[model samples]
Target: MTATKRCIRAEDLYQIRYTSDPQLSPNGKSVAFVETMIDEQRQYRNHLVLQSLDSKDLTSLTVGAVRDTFPRWSPDGATISFVSNRSGTPQIWLIDAKGGEARQLTRCKTGVSNPIWSPDGKHIVFSSMLSPEDSFSDVEGESKKEVQKVIVVNRMKYKSDDHGYIYDKSKQIAIVNVESGEMRAISEGPYNHTVGAWSPDGEWLAITANRAENPDKQHSIDVYLVPFSGGEWKKVTKSKGTFFFPTWSPDGKKLALIGSESDTHLHAAQKRVWVYNLENDEQTCITAEWDVQVGDSTIGDVRSPGHPNPGAVWREDGKGMYFIASERGNSGIYHTTLDGQITQIVGGSRNVYGFSLHEKAQKLIMVVSDTASPGDLVEVDLDTKEEQRLTDVNHDLFAELELPAVEEIEFEAEDGWKLHGWLMKPVGYQQGQKYPMVLQIHGGPHSMYGNTYFHEFQVLAAKGYAVLYTNPRGSFGYGERFVQACCGDYGGNDYLDLMSAVKYACNHFDFVDETRLGVTGGSYGGLMTNWIVGQSNQFKAAVTDRSICNWLSFYGVSDIGYYFTAEEIMANPFNNPEKMWHHSPLRLAANIETPLLIMHGEQDHRCPIEQAEQLYIALRYHDKAPVSFIRFPGASHELSRSGDPQQRVLRLEYTADWFESYLLTAEKASV
Candidate 1:
């Protein structure tokens, strides 16, 4: 007899392989992409993989334990430009499409990223952070000496999450010649600059920057263009809001961009598609009435580090362009005309994270993922919407495991607002059997819990527990008003929305045991988890990661605390201390009666580790329920998503262990 498939375990993370950044060749006959996996050392290994569209033959173009990503095909498709760190730091590298040894192109001390070829393919443009006095050729080898220097902070945005300090270096755009191996800066200043699209004629390159005198205090990031010969930059937008990912039209008369006009509450602002007419200098929002956020906003943790959003893929005829959009729970490909008409090119219950267009073939190669599927490259016919699976990086591993299927749930909140969510029954579940349910909340509060593969949820389901996740009022994909509704009302209506969903799930689902309930989330979700346990002891166990306990402290400590707290909560410590304290989860610490497990990254500047420390001490000081804290050394806010592979696995194991300890019976816990 054949053996039954085993349930997915936390260690299955090592067996899973991720593929991203699919780049279709100029002729639309082949594809070059990046494949990533964890090696024996628990470090990430990425390489370029080339495959023919017709034969489906796969070949690795570059091989190393180091990262090789952001593959961009040259104009003639003869060579591919990619970013690699084999020599110590990331730099642009070129390799022939067919095969051969790759050649390093840039020698900048600072690493480069977002590498794109000029229209003529003679030069590759990339962005890098460099000191004001440093040039592309200032490649001085560093001395292996350890020293401690006092950190001087003059800017409000000095410390960030992953990149600790940002006062010394600024992002600049530069170009490197493929043949001469020479590099020159196109735009330079003590300001951040990002590479956009190159004009079809290769005369100008569109860039995203904020050259305002006080950019640190402003939210206006506009588009600009610099000539190939390198001179003054001509501002394209009026600097009214945040704009980026500018793509030039085929005729070079227009530029399609994805951004928002809101300056203050950008996190709640809807990402819309806009068009700029260079001839008349008119800017219009094309996706204004679409009621969908442009670009892929679906949140998932399965993919590798390098997933670039391929902004707007202009059609060959230049009448319209293809872009990714999110609505409800799925993010799909959409097409819009210059006149504002829109159509769905590809719609599904999945997340189209990235895609590349092949104008000649009338097809697009997309990196797509859904619940139960990590992600894979898919070829879709634009007209018919017919999809063909291209690569299966984790097919073998998935075939041996039994993954839970998500059941979409639509229920009304307490205030009559309809909310969307998903429920996953325990693995090997039987009808009429009671099971402990864990409510999983997503961070970003602005981000959505969509139909994407989340390993953490799968691990909980495998532990014989039902997993419930929902996109509450503050989540994307539900229109602008719904997403913005939870901003000012932190633990108010958003709290009610989550509790209503849990109540709905328990009332509707027969297998859910209301008495044995648990809650967990990270960041904003963590804040909400803290809020939920304090408001009522409906939950028996809770796990909060990278959470915020005190709003007053977070307003001063977090990287974006200065602006985020003011904008999201509609109050600051100086102006409205009482409101901030009233909304803070720390104020309700004495009411927490559930067993809690707090997890945080030591290096998390976004939601500093001090937030966790404060909460742990407060709970113990109040002598409430049991509380435990776990600090991941050297990890950042991205610990759960892109931290060390081993730590990510451990996080899952710890979460499951915590939930099991509190919610499960001794008989089931032992099993």
Candidate 2:
């Protein structure tokens, strides 16, 4: 242990800054990125920053506590376009590359996002909300009213955790002139649209949308080409699965996209890169044979919102494309040819969450994070394979703290399936001494916990608790079979994988005290926690956040419940009532004997607060062990990740307090 270093606290989250959305200039001399920090008001303040590659000098482009993000350099590198709420709504704003006052470019009432420059830099295209009967001109003249409104529900997917009340609003593509600020909706529809990339000749814009019958009922989004002059869209992709991030090749002969070929399994389907030849109207999966999942699947709390996706970037010569993929415990940059020949460009024990490549200059700038650091921009030379750190946003905060080192663990499940995980020892550790340990499970059961910085896990380690986090069988970063193993099985083999992990850790690590064990997780992880406490009494304390207690209620309550329930569980409440009830943790609530802390977001539409309420009520009615409940008023499913800053801190504080109260004695906790 160091003399000057101290243990991290929950409030240290405010001191941790994050960097994301790195955009390389066309000239490859400087990079434009977004730096986000928590202000005194507990609100996120995101500002665009320009860093010179030659001198490593940084200059802030936008000012104040307002959010200014998604900075995209113009085709000529003379101006940068970004989205900002300075005008009270997230609208497109433009500033010169050299520096100056940023001017508002759009005044859309509903706001716009994902702005991209045209090939000639004369116009910009973005996505904005538009009702079925409203046009761009109507949106500009519209003003919101605060009076009471009537409620109408006609669709299955009517509410969303991120955006509530998806009634008649649809995300449509809109275009605006840079010089005149004249804008209008280019694609109008009842279905939502996502802007991709503009064709090299500036005649068509590629987008992803589901215009099929009953679009919301199925997970089918295909790539389509919309004319710049406005008309009917040309469907380019065969409607076989979900597709997104359509990028045009340098020569405009092909389009590189990142998506999947099957939508049945949804999250279990590995995101693959496919190239659509514009000449032949044929699509081919470039990474079909590669087992690794494409895109950044690593989960973390410090990641800034709206981090730009590093979609498939075509090489300058148009022979291959570069993209990011998750494998083992790292998200690395990879390149693949048209025939599925893949090559690893840069890989390590770190998470490359965001990236931008300058094909002509062979320069790659990526936002990389490890176990100790939040994230920073790193420049890599394609030819030389050299790397250089461009920013250190959290260096000072981390320098004064003794961050724990993470040890990767590879063990076998009870079923002989291999599993991956990481163990972080408590700060200021001493040999031959036993310490309480906390088994931290990740959400998504489909989302992987890789070599990324997690504030919650670090805080627990600082409080003298060894942290054990794992990517069980249901987690990503593994193959298709492993990821799909937990689906339809729920608390079956997935529960065994977690229990086997705890057994493996206890037997292998002598310092871990198996008697004083604690468990906590959120979302699907929360469901597992509830399931564990009901099935076993091995854990002394357990905290479940945003959990699902009853599958019957979750199917109709959650935003994506209608489809997510049928796909993941392979059963519905009406058709298979016995199966759904049999797998619900609430059904076995009477078996829980451990001290349980129930926490959930009041506005969490994903799991809904009622789920937490049901478990708490059931536990109290049965008088089984000790149970407590906490609720955040304005928080949602992302409470631990991107919820209110104050509430996020409180969630961690309550979690640690609950575990410490149950697992540690006063004398040991004081030590």
Candidate 3:
């Protein structure tokens, strides 16, 4: 007889670990990736691991207190360079690939991150903040110290109350000589520059900079080229749209960058990739006919999956570049030529992250995911298109568990827009026996819901709840036009599309009980949950995390609020405050009848905690609904993914408990 599976709590069963950011060595003989492991103490820690191409022998390169990431190999392949905070603050560390004590390279009071090795391997380029200094007086020849202070007077529209504001330090690129240990500033200015890439000859460095005349504008980000030896910076493109993820061609004659030229919140207006010629300074749109924008384009409280943050690299021959595209489903890697002819290199239910080419072997190494697994390193044969799994980090844990099965579904929105969705039936589910259903909405209204494994979804299914998540309009993986359809029409057609997904599941799935329905999400998804509770009584319980409730207040509070509001949500916060209010879920709190469990981090700089407090207070004041508020101490906006370990488990338990009290209990009462 098959052994009875032990019941896995939402917290205990969700400790599955995986690998990410796989970096192939320069010689193509070995691969290094960030291996995330959950220890016996249940603490999540990251360490660098190496695997040989020939023997497939895996070895751990780092072990200790701090986390190590962004492993890049030197040109000689004898040493590996990475970032770590072992010395109190994040700094560059170098260690032999065979494993030994890592030597600290940079010792700055501030932190250093995003380390990229120059082509020659003699220098490492990274970005960090500059130290603050006193202002100098020319006439008096006396130094005047400017005291920087931060004050939080009230907690209203801003989400995070405990967030302490400090003096702003612009992130500048710096180069450290590997041999001399000499650190020199390569690019210095008032504007922050990040996401650096090196040219083949190491003569130039390409980076995505917000050095525009109006750096405050969220849409003003563009790519720029700077001399590797440190001098003047040159703008590559002048479009007012957001451009990032700059990848230089092998020949260094052209740059393959992802960008969008429109300000519309919809995917269509925000999705496009451009190739710029360095010689002529001419630009060409490669994805113009894809009818979809690339990257998530929503300003505030909304996200899209299509925004390719880690841009793909060009083939060694520079004939084509590999990139991930998402329109209506999960993201997949595709090869696109300069002429815009695209070919799907890896197509599956899962999302394919950026790939590293093994030029000599004609193989591609990538990170991929599906509903059953979080993410794993896989190698695909470029010519044969065959995929082979390289890592089994989570295999042992998952093999003993009974995970949910994700099935794709489609439904028509209120406006007849076709939407895609995925449904996860309860574990040990039986036909005829009704179960509670949870509707999971993805943020980035531009982000697509695909075959990727979601911990929360699996935990809900294990607890006898059927989970349903959909790719509404504005979701990626479908192509440009479909994604942009929801732009400027937040909580309108997208709301209908999500509701239709719920309706379709209830009607088609035999075990789904319509009366026992719950909804939960984080970030943009969190905003939708707030909007859903306010607009409908169909859901019995709802949980919203790191959400934006009011756009007017968010405009000044969020780091990206000013630009996101102006470009994605509103034309101008000053003139469009009413429109922002109209789209805000907080404005309709009076109509909410569903019990809400509001969750937010104390240190969330993205969507502050005040947004949660506002909804919690409003719900408590209402006699019609029950409410609960939970704050994660010392947690940031990314509490769900990168927060404290214990808190992450608690958050999941809280969500399950909220639904258990409302949805499951209500179903039992009716029975």
Candidate 4:
């Protein structure tokens, strides 16, 4: 008799380790990265970890209760600098590569982030939120005393999902003395400045900012070169499209940027790669005809929502570039020439979350993940295209956990739209037995369900349910045409495409029990769940999470409502009330026949908790369908991925119980 392996539990996610920001040392023998985990107290604890290729051993540089992240090796490779909240406020901290006590380098009043060491390694450039103290040397206590508590807001983009209110302070670029720990503001103005790559000569720092007189109204943000010695900044690109993540060439004569022409199209715009020449001030699109979007656009619920793409890196000779892009569900590294000739470097059905390149060594360090693995660091050979596992952070836990096997498949929609998706089989199965199917929809509608590890899906499959997730019309990674196909067309072909995926699965896979089917999703996916249930009663149960029910009201409550409302639906609530109501799921709430469960976060500013409340009220008031609503207290829009540990576990447990209760007759509720 064979002993049964332990199945993955919902609570097992807390023990999983997440890795990011891999930095290759100058000598390319050592790599410094960030390792984060959730503690019992429900707080994120970050540690600076180092690994050596020669010794094949791991070392923790800074480990404690506080958060430390964004480890970057200096040019000399003697010391590593990172951002930490050890002193109650986030500031730049530095420690020797040989290992010792870390010393705080910056004492910014508003806090500092995104630290980049100068080429000479004598100074570090970072972005920090500023205050009007008349001096940059004000200490913490004195700085707070100078500012008033009351905040007056007057900007259209006053609040964001990550930041509740960003009216009082704006981010400014500054430089810090490495040895003396002294800092001075470099670029301080009414607008914010985002740090990009530093020029090779250390004279100019590339920055992306909308310096237009009225930045909030315009979506145009161009890359500019700011002087390190402090002076007026010069714009390098003149484009109507929005631009970001500018990377300077090794020779500092050119810059590679990521942008698109769909500022009004919201996230539906296809991100294109462009090269900007500083000498002639000429900007040319490199990937305009490539059809594929640039940068890592794959979406996953396993990691943090706001993952920053460091942009394209110039080759050692400054003739080509290496970047990561989401293509056909896989986020992999690719190479492109100055004339737009593209080639795949490390392409496959695996997710490359973050990468760091050592130009001198011709080696790349990346954080890789897949359906079976959350994340691990790996070393990649640029010339050979060979990958060697460097760190097996989750190997122990993964070995003991029984996860379902995932298989990718392709099918055509009713309108002949070719799409790709993955189906995860049940953990343990009999030859002739059929299992209930759970169809999952992704949140961003813009974000694709790619080749990434998702703990929630694993727990559902471990409970004897087959899972089906697809990238509908609006998801990224397919191409510009496919991604922009769903703009101003929500609840239309996209809805039918989802149903087609289920139909394809039921017909193609004999193990899928179509009679016992359920559908669920969060954010835009949640909106679809509400729409799916109302539009069709084919599924026995449905769960909508952090979803938008009434678009008419969502326009006023959501953080991105003002512009996103018009960008997505093509009109504001006041201008097209009838169209907005017609698109809202609440309008068709009475037609919902399937059992519905509403889930949301109380502090979710993106979709807002009011969305769930409205849907619950509409469903409950009429008593049309058996409905339940679960609200995670103090949880934000990212509850399922990076929310409170206990809360996240509870959410998965609740989701599994909900599906089991409806899918199987003899299923017992898990507490």
Candidate 5:
């Protein structure tokens, strides 16, 4: 009998690609999306591509090293506008829909993003930072240098490593004449404002603003109405919570906004859609019991809505609104009436991102994705609920590879609470032989591991390891109560839930070898792996990536240390250092017996490389286990997703080698 492939390497992983940000033209004759490709040099870049409705005559609009995204069709569908950083900094660029050389629209020293064309297509409104010198005043009596000194940071989480430094120059909404290039700030203040939509009548522009004295401290975001001609802003709604992403109704009588209750933790917050009446200014929550959040943000603000694409659309008659909500285990598009009744319009195996509705043709052009495919463009008939795939970006990739099958699993925690997880067995398996198991952990104890296409998980299964991942108590997708379970108790119940998943997988799958188990994860998952080996020696080997080892030091060092340690974990560096140390994995390093490999980015401000250094030093000092540390230069916390391509490939290869040496071969394991 021939033996199955003992282990898979990084080179064996399939090359899968997908498209996103699908935008349909007003006439419904053509569709556009951001097509991402790995060049011959292995560098990732995206460009705008157009495809006709009737034929597959695809055309690439933007080219070269520049990455273009967020393509928005003009009101008349004559032009397309997008944001690109090809010119050193991200700026707005316009190109004719038919085809021509793209023209630069904005030339500010800082940068501009999210350009929205007015109703008449005569002007374009976008968010950007003006120069600090522009805000200085010329004193009457003294020279301009005599003013008192003040440091200004406009928005909450001003010092973001990923987005760079945000100054006192708030991202005010600026409008520019499409023809003459004349520009004016319609909504101006020390506060930050983002444009939502322009009323059909062109009298008012709907916008979202967070203008509190301490914008960072205030969790609530409010929507406002600003005159198109430029004047005082009118407040539409006020609350202790955050409210944003204001979309105007077609008739201009009502406004739709995404609201979140708080920011204690990712799961502790409740997100919903609310409609505000223009006359009474009364806000009604449309998603009261849906247990779904509507927006996405890099920072921890629950109130800030995700960037609006064609996903949220106003009905042509203005009697109803349509938005995408992730509930019932998947995200789907739903239409809600004025009476607060919601009807599911599109239901399927894939998640609906956003849709462009053509009322005249009764057709809905949307971006959807399943577990196997990354994402693709599709069209659905709103009336008939019939769907058809439009793009085949990943068809060849899927056909050539044998992907792992993911199944949802539920297991009871030690405390009788049920937990959710996803399990992926080897692609080609036998009945009698056992396979090595790898417990994969996700970052953001609050981030959920859903039915999505995860390249890492697929690659691991292809390498002959049965992979298991779970969304512990603090993960999203479940309601508020399920998420708050991990607030102050980080390594407590969440750790137990993961332990229970491992046990369940071992008991149910006879092909899993309990003795040859290996574990790996990044970010929060990295923290868990560190905590796991320190507490138990059940696993033969472990790898932790960008993990947190010492909480006391993290509180003072990390960018979000001050807020996250105090608000979320409810711990302080001065008073509760012991509790923080007790939860830290470094404290229990002496008990760790498994051979461990630690990987981190050199410039990760979120969880600095010192965290990995502390763990490595502790393990080596005690002489209890073999420990190795690898650092990627100039890399950040997002190395797994957006790191340098060559470095990312090496990182994955290093992780697989560590596991293969320890778990696959007994001779290497003993050494």
Candidate 6:
């Protein structure tokens, strides 16, 4: 008798743990990373973990009901500074890398973020929230529990999906002395100042902010260098578009930047890497000819914390740098020389989400993920580019579960464009039996569905449904032009690309049941799902999560709707209402013949929940197609990934049940 393995269920979400922000020690002998998991109380806990390379010993720096993140090593590696809410509000906390009780570093009223140790290791530079009316160093002991009972929205950028309601607040740079715990604001102004990197000399700090005359109307951000001793900020890379995240070279002569030209086509512009020289005050586009978008733009079921994604790391020699780019369905680390030569350093069909490098020790640590794994820490050889798996954080959870095998598929569209995607087979599949297939679409139309492990896909496979997901032309990983292709052509060719993949799968894969097809996606993927079900009756079931049905209204309600609607659909609602409505899925929602499920987060500001209300109401007018709406309270657009643990599970349960009940039970009922 053969033993069968238990398939992964929706409840497995709680069992999955997320590890990130891996910071190598100054001596490169140890690494400090944050591991986040759902606690017994149904809340999330983040703890700092330290592991030594010599003895292979791992230790927890901090533990218990709190979030300890953004760990940074001191110059001597004696202490580690992190931001934690253990004391009721998030502030800088310090702990010995050797393991001991953590001591609070800063007790600022406004929460602190992105702690960076100075070169001398005497001071730490961080940004904290401050009201527009408050001065830069407003450290008056105001109660942290002051609730904003009423929100007065004056600016166009009043609310955002990331920070919710921070219109009245600005993020200003502040410095905290390590020894005495004395803190003072460095760069103080009405505008926000995001810390990027410190000069090797410790005299200058690179930051980006929108300090324009009319910051709200301006779409681009400027990179500026502020003095550590408190002086006037100097505008560095005065690029036409929004460029940030300045990585300083070892010699501090040049700075590596990732941004796009915002002077024109702000919406369709692609993120490219550039190098700005301090001596001549000139910037060179390093990755412009590479034709790929910079940074890790891969989409998955797991949503990382608000920490900025890992960017370019300057070489010690200052001649080149190592950066991550989305290329052909995978986010790979590549090496780019100042002379415009590019080489793939750690190239593969894998997602390298985060990495840390130490030149003197010749050591490199990478946080990697693929189809079979959520994420794990690995050591990558700097010279040979060889990788060694260092941590198996999810090995125990994965050992007890049977995960469906994920395979990559590729086919050429009618327009001769090669499309890339992956397919997850139903768990415990029979050789000759067919199963219902669900077409999964990813958001970002600019983001690619690549090597990352998706918990949502596993849940569907556990329910005996094959999941098919693809990166259409508009998706990243392919190239700049491919991503921009979907800009003005919302549902035009991108919709066809999805349908062609579905047709190809049904014809080539005998395991898929053509008549019992289902489709689901979130964000832009959700919009595509709504479009698919509305335009085609071929889909028997559809689930749209945090989707937009009416682009005309989406232009006003969404955080970035005003610009995104114009850039994405190429139609300003004010100038072209007819065109915006024409591209909107709401125009076809009443024509949807498939049973639909509208899933949304009430606090979703990206694609506001109002979009869901409009979608459900439009479908209600017909009432022919069975439709239902589920709202997750206090959940943002990331409800599927990092929302409340219970709510996340409920989302997966609802999505899986709706597809199973309709694709199978409804199919049998008709028989």
TM-score for each of the candidates? 0.98, 0.98, 0.91, 0.96, 0.89, 0.97
Query: Across residues 90-171, which tens digit of lDDT does each residue of candidate 1 receive?
Result: 9888899998998988877878889989888898889888766578776635633355387566777777785766666778
Over the stretch 412-473, how does candidate 6's per-residue lDDT look in tens digits? 78787888888888988888988999999998777788888889998898888999999897
Which lDDT values do the candidates have, in the order given? Answer: 0.88, 0.89, 0.75, 0.84, 0.75, 0.84
Q: Report how far residue 639 has shifted in candidate 4, in Å.
A: 1.2
Which lDDT tens digits does candidate 3 get at residues 1-671?
12756444666533667677788887787899887666667666678999887788999999866778778889889999988877767778999999999998887656677888888889998877652341111112233445548544332222322224433446677788998778777666556778568998999888887775555444467788888766787888784676778888889999988877665542345556789998898989987887644542222111112222457568888888877676456667777888889887777667665457776787778877777777788988877888888887777777678876678898788778777887898888776888889998877666666767677787788888999988787776676667666667788888888899999999989888898899998888999999999999999899898898887887787755765666557545677677888899989999999988899998887787888888888877876788889999888876776666678889889999899999787667867
Q: After superposition, how far is residue 671 of candidate 2 from its true place, in Å?
A: 9.6
RMSD of each: 1.7, 1.4, 4.7, 2.3, 5.0, 1.9
* Pairs that collide, model 6: 241-262, 328-477
Off by over 4 Å in 4: 1-4, 131-138, 141-151, 666-671
Model 5 accuracy (lDDT, Cα): 0.75
| lDDT (Cα, tens digit) per residue for candidate 4, span 1-671 | 01557788888887888888888899999999988888777678989999998797899999879889889888988999999999878888889999999988887666778889889998888887664433456554444454567877777767666766666456788788998988887776667788888899999889888777887777677788888887887887663668889988988899999887565675778788889888887888888788876777766656766565778888989998888888788888888999989998887788997888887887899998889888889898877878899988887887787778898999999999998999999888666888899999998878778888988888888888899999999898898788878777889999999999999999999999898999999999999999999999899988888899988888878888767768777777678888888888999988988989888999899999999999899888889888999999988888887788888888888888777778876433321
List the candidates ranked by TM-score, beginning with the highest. Answer: 2, 1, 6, 4, 3, 5
Candidate 4, residue 348: Cα displacement in angstroms equals 1.4
Q: What does candidate 6 score on TM? A: 0.97
Question: Which portions of model 1 miss their true places by more than 4 Å?
Answer: 143-148, 666-671
Q: Any runs in candidate 5 off by more than 4 Å, and if so which?
A: 1-15, 134-158, 166-170, 186-190, 263-267, 295-311, 667-671
Give the number of the best model, judged by lDDT: 2
Give per-residue CA lDDT, model 5, range 1-671, as digits (tens): 12522333354332445677777788888887787666667666778998887786789998888778779899899999998877767777899998889987776556677788888888888877643454212111233455548766544465444654455556677887888767776755676777788888888888888877777566457778888987787888774567666788877888887766564542356567778898886888877856664532111100112334442577888777787766424667788777777788876645665567777678777766666766678888877888888888877656667767677788899999877777888778777988899998888776566555666766778777889888778776677677677778878988898899999999988999999899888888898999999888989999999999998998866767766776556788787888888888998899999999999998888888899999999998999888899999988888777666667778888887888888888844556
Give the Cα error of residue 527 in candidate 1, in Å.
0.7
The per-prediction tally of clashing pairs is 0, 0, 35, 0, 5, 2
